[model samples]
Target: MLLELIEYHWAEDIDEVLLLLGRLDVKTVPLAGGTYLLGLHDDSIESVVDLRDLDLAYISEDARGIHIGAMTTLQQMVDSPLLKELFAGLLARAAKNSSSSRLIRNSATIGGTIATGSASQADLLTALAVLDAEVVVRSGSKTQVDLKGGSYEHPGLALAGVVYKGKHERRIPSGEVQLSRRPAELIIEVVIPRPTLAVGTALMRVSRTPADVSLLHAAALIEIDAHTYRKVHLALGGSNMEPVRLYGVEQMLEGQPVMNPLNSQKLLTILQEGMATFRPPADIRASSSYRRVSGMGLAYRALEEAMNVASWQNVMSSERGS
Candidate 1:
C-alpha cells in the first residue's frame, strides 16, 4: 500500500506503454482505471504505466460482433444502448449487477476486471463466458485468444498466452508457452460474436445483500430453431477462482425440444447429479455444500429463463409473419 516509492509514467500510446513495461530495471504494471492496482499491496511493483492517454475506450459493433475496448468502465457498459438491445441486455445487466456502488462501477475498467482474476465478479464473468467472448491482446505481437466455450482455464490466462487463439489473428495454441514463461501482454479489447439464429440469454446470482458479492451465480445462452435447441451454453461461478461452463449439461440440452415435461425432469436430474459430483471451494462467506445447492438451483433457473425467452421470440416471429 506504500505509494511514496512508486513512480507513475503517463503513456501516450501502446508502444510507449509496452516499452515502459519491458524495462528490466524495474517491475512495472499497466494502469487503466487504477481501481485494481491501488488495492494491491505488493512491494515489488516499482512503476505504473498509465494508459488513459491511449484512447482505448469505445464501444462499437460490426458484422463480426460487438467490440468493447479494454478501458471501458462498468458504468459505461451499463449505459450502453447497444448492449441493452443485444441478447436481451445480458451484458448490460451483468455490468449493472457487478457492483452496487456507482463509484466502483465508474472507476473499474473492463480490462482490469478480467485481469484482476477476482472470483467475486462471477456474475459478470459468467455472462461473458456464456457469450463465448474473445479477448484481444497485444505485446510484441497481437493475438485473439478464444474462451473456447468457457472451457479455458481462466480469462486472465489469455493474457499469459495459455489460451488458444483462432486462425484469424496470430494463433497461439495452448501449451506453446507456459503461463510462467509468457511475456507481459496487454488486453486491447473483447469481441463477442453476434448470434446468427434466434438466441436468448439469462444471468442469475445469489448474494446476502445487493451490495455483497455473489455466493453463487449462473449464466445461460440458448439458440433455438423450429422449437428445437440448436445450441446451448451454461456457466457457473462465485465459489471458485474461475468460472466453469457446464459442458455436460449444455450437451444434454442441445438438439433437444425446448423443454417438454419429460425434458425438464431429465435436465433437472442431470444438473443435480453434476452439481453433486463437483465440489466448490469453501470460504468464510458460505460453505461448499451451500454453494453446491445454490449452483444447482441457479443453473436450472437460468436455463429455464433463457428457454422461455427463446419461446417468446418464436411467438413474436410467428405473429409478425401472419
Candidate 2:
C-alpha cells in the first residue's frame, strides 16, 4: 500500500493554518514535521499545510517554565541545556536513543509527539506518564492537561507543546521502556519527575516477524511512602480503545509497604489479574494470551523497578540526615 504524495502548503501564520483547517475536509491533517502526518497522506488525506514558517517549532526558556514549541525538533531537545538539567529524566532519556540521525529529531515536534502520543503506543509515553505530565492545547480556547487523557484530541491545526515548570532547582528523575521490533521503529518518550515509588512501563510485543503499531502497552505512576505506598496512577495504551487508567491495579497497590515481601507478591498478582480484563482481539502478530503474558511482565517489571528506586531513595535520605 503506497501513500500518494499530497500537495504541500506552507502557512506563515497560525490564522492562515486555522483558516485552512476550517475550509478543508476533515482529512486535511496539519503537518508539523511530517513524522506522523505524512503517513496519513494516502490513507485518508490529500493535502498538508506545512507549519515550519509559523515559528511554532523551537524551544523557549523562561523562569516560569520551559516552553517547548510544538514544532521544535528532537535534536534541539537532545542538546537543550534546560532539558538536560531540569527535565533530564524525561527529555534526556527519551530523546537520547531516538536515532543516531539528527535529521529525524530535527523534524520531530513536541506538539506532534503529544498529539500523536506514539510513545505510549510505542512504549515511550510510559516515561512521561511516569512523570504525571500532559499537553497544553489551544483550539478555540486554551486548555491545560496536568494529568493524562485528551492527548489524542487532534483538534486539527492548533497551537501545541509539552510545557514544564522551570522553577524547580534539582534535576528531575524519570525512566522509560520501549517495546520495539527494531531500534527506531514507532515509539514514545516517557518522562518522570522523581523516581521514588512511581513506575512507568511501555510494553509492545512484536511477535509478527516485524510488528507495527503494537499489541498492548501500559503506563504507571505509583508513589510508595517510607513504609507504605500512597498513591498510584496507571495508564493503558494499545491495550484498550483509548488510553485508559487502570483502577484495578491502583486499588491493589496504593497502600502497600515498600519492602514487604508478601505485599509485593500480592501487588504483582493483583496487577496480572487487572490486566486480564484487557481483551485485545487477535491480530496477525499475536494471540490474546501472549499479549496478556507479555503485558503482565512489563507491568511487574515497572512496578518492581519503581519500588527499588523508592527503597534506595529512603536509604539515601536517611544517610543524608544522619
**Number of the top candidate by lDDT?**
1
Candidate 1: clashing pairs of residues? none
> Residue 164 lDDT in model 1?
37
Angstrom error at residue 193, model 1: 1.0
- Top model number, TM-score: 1
Clashes of each: 0, 13
What does the lDDT read for residue 137 in candidate 2?
Answer: 34
Candidate 2 residue runs with Cα over 4 Å from true position: 1-7, 24-27, 41-46, 58-67, 78-103, 117-121, 140-218, 236-244, 260-264, 317-322
**What is the clash tally of candidate 2?**
13
Query: Mind giving the per-residue lDDT tens digits that candidate 2 earns over 75-111?
Result: 7777878666542244554554433456766776655
Computed on alpha carbons, the lDDT of every model, listed in order, comes to: 0.76, 0.52
TM-score of each: 0.84, 0.63
